[model samples]
Target: MVFVQYTVLGIFFLMELCALAAFSYWGFHLNRGWFIKILLGIGAPLLVAIFWGTFIAPKASIPVSIPVRIILQLIIFALAIAALYFSSKSMLAVVFLVVVVVEMIIMYSMGW
Candidate 1:
């Protein structure tokens, strides 16, 4: 049981990393100048990292209730899925969404 819980947590961490990558991927694929691409590709994930560290991380600077935290997480995941979809990775987006939904269900059931 402990191992399963830890595994789920690890998967959640991977999902977070995937969200950042989705942002970067979307930014890079935009039909814009190289400079703009570079800025957004780097900046989007940087801003997200800052926000997550500040409010959503395990040791967040400004902690919120679990429900709020879950909502914030879902928003991020949704944005990531949208990013992938708009970037022409519809299959990947669907897969990510399914994984996120399943993981969220497990996480909630496990009280994590």
Candidate 2:
């Protein structure tokens, strides 16, 4: 049970990484100038990372209730799914959504 718990946590961390990658992928694929592309590709994930570290990380600087944290997490993951879908990766988006849903369910059930 402990192993499963830690594994789920690890998967959650990977999901966060995937979200950043999704943002970068979307930004780079935008039909815009190189400057804009570079700015967004790097900046989007940076902003997300800052936000996560500030409010959503395990040892967040500004902690909230579990419900609020979960809501924020869902919002971020939703944005990542949208990014993947808009970037012509609908299948990947769906798969990501499924994994996110399962992870959230397990986390909530396990009180993680």
Candidate 3:
């Protein structure tokens, strides 16, 4: 089960990388703004964080400390909403929203 999970996640990450690469290429070709690129970079880790916390970590036997976890969750959520609230462009907000959604999805999935 662990091996299968790893394989699936590996593929998912690879897909994300490919999408990032394509975005980079498109950015270079079209000269999209810097914020857009940065937003894309942020999305990658956020996705992993969300996936692991939600889909993977809960199955582990040991209990994670709730207070610290809650703090971290709030931080991510704030970043997501903050990016939207502060900025005019869609890319930043969208990227952060993706992160926020991923985090929430995992938390919800694990019944946290």
Q: What lDDT score is found at residue 16 in candidate 3?
A: 41
Error of 1 at 17 (Å): 0.5
Pairs with steric clashes in candidate 3:
54-106
What is the number of backbone collisions in each predicted candidate, taken in the order shown? 0, 0, 1
Over the stretch 1-112, how does candidate 2's per-residue lDDT look in tens digits? 9999999999999999999999999999999999999999999999999999999998999998999999999999999999999999999999999999999999899888
Q: What is candidate 1's CA lDDT for residue 39?
A: 97
Write down the TM-score of every candidate: 0.98, 0.98, 0.34
Identify the candidate with maximal lDDT.
2
- Could you tell me how far off, in angstroms, the CA of residue 112 lies in candidate 1 after the best superposition? 1.1
lDDT of 1: 0.96
Q: lDDT tens digits, residues 47-89, model 3?
A: 6455446633446344457665555555544543544444343
How does each model score on lDDT?
Answer: 0.96, 0.97, 0.50
Off by over 4 Å in 3: 1-63, 89-112
Alpha carbon deviation, residue 49, candidate 3 (Å): 3.0
Q: Worst 10-residue stretch by lDDT in candidate 2?
A: 103-112
